[model samples]
Target: MTISMDQQQTLGLSPNTLKGVHHIALNVKDMATSRHFYGAVLGLHELTGDEVPETLVTLVAQGKVANFRLPDGTILDLFGEPDLDAPHADPKQQFTRANHMAFDIAPELFDQAVAMLHQQQVPIDHGPVSRPTGRGIYFYDPDGFLLEIRCDP
Candidate 1:
């Protein structure tokens, strides 16, 4: 049996309507630190109040939020909720990378990104290792969330 476009949409499996991820939201312990890391260290542009939509402001009024735009226009939202607990990933577990975010960078800039991570004193948890896709450097955010910078080439 085959599924029609209308059937796919009805079942919420329509890839045509789903372009890509618009944003990723993370609960952060310290808003200022996370903001600086994403804004200053990672060099993502944080959206100002004027840049954020009024609808979003009203929706997330319970906690402070910092919106950072990736190069491709994807937004990373940091929600300020210090009390929220983050689950630690056990190295022995197969799902160590079960909840991580990866960012793409040019192959040539890979070295610079590694250097920047070091200059910022962010310890690399793993690679700068080669994979079928590309080289990647894994590190953690200030809130202990795993993050990776992979070469797009």
Candidate 2:
């Protein structure tokens, strides 16, 4: 899957133009539950004031948006919409399960994460198994969005 310089030039590709993810926005069923899950269970910091974009806040009603900061400075924005009808993909198929967010944790905290998930009663959809990347687990959020926690060592 390596592309030569000529090929890259022919495709008008520019190196280093694309940056990593800035934020990920999701629509949730319950604001309180989602806030607790991301802010408490996962231990992410919730942003306030000008930290959130004015456009995103105005898209919905007031106080419907909650933004959580990841350890790597990526923002996870949650929109509270009680009647959201988002479709969840089945994890059995490869492509279907491709649409997921995977977060990395320290290798030592991997076991502790599993324990927390268990204590919280979140059902694991796939694994806490070893992969090319690391040990990981697939689980669903309260709103049925697929999420993964991987420990790279």
Clashing pairs in 1: none
Output the lDDT of residue 57, model 2: 54
Query: In candidate 1, what are the lDDT values of residues 46-145, reduced to their tens digit?
Result: 8776777454675445548777889989878777777755455554544222245667666776787787778667868998898555677889999788
Residue pairs whose backbone atoms clash in candidate 2: none
lDDT of 2 at 109: 70
The TM-scores, one per candidate, come to 0.47, 0.47
Off by over 4 Å in 2: 1-9, 57-61, 85-153
* Candidate 1 error regions (>4 Å): 1-12, 58-63, 89-153
RMSD of each: 17.8, 17.1
lDDT of 2 by residue, 74-114 (tens): 87888777886446555354432123576667677777777
Q: Residue 143 of candidate 1: its Cα lDDT?
A: 75
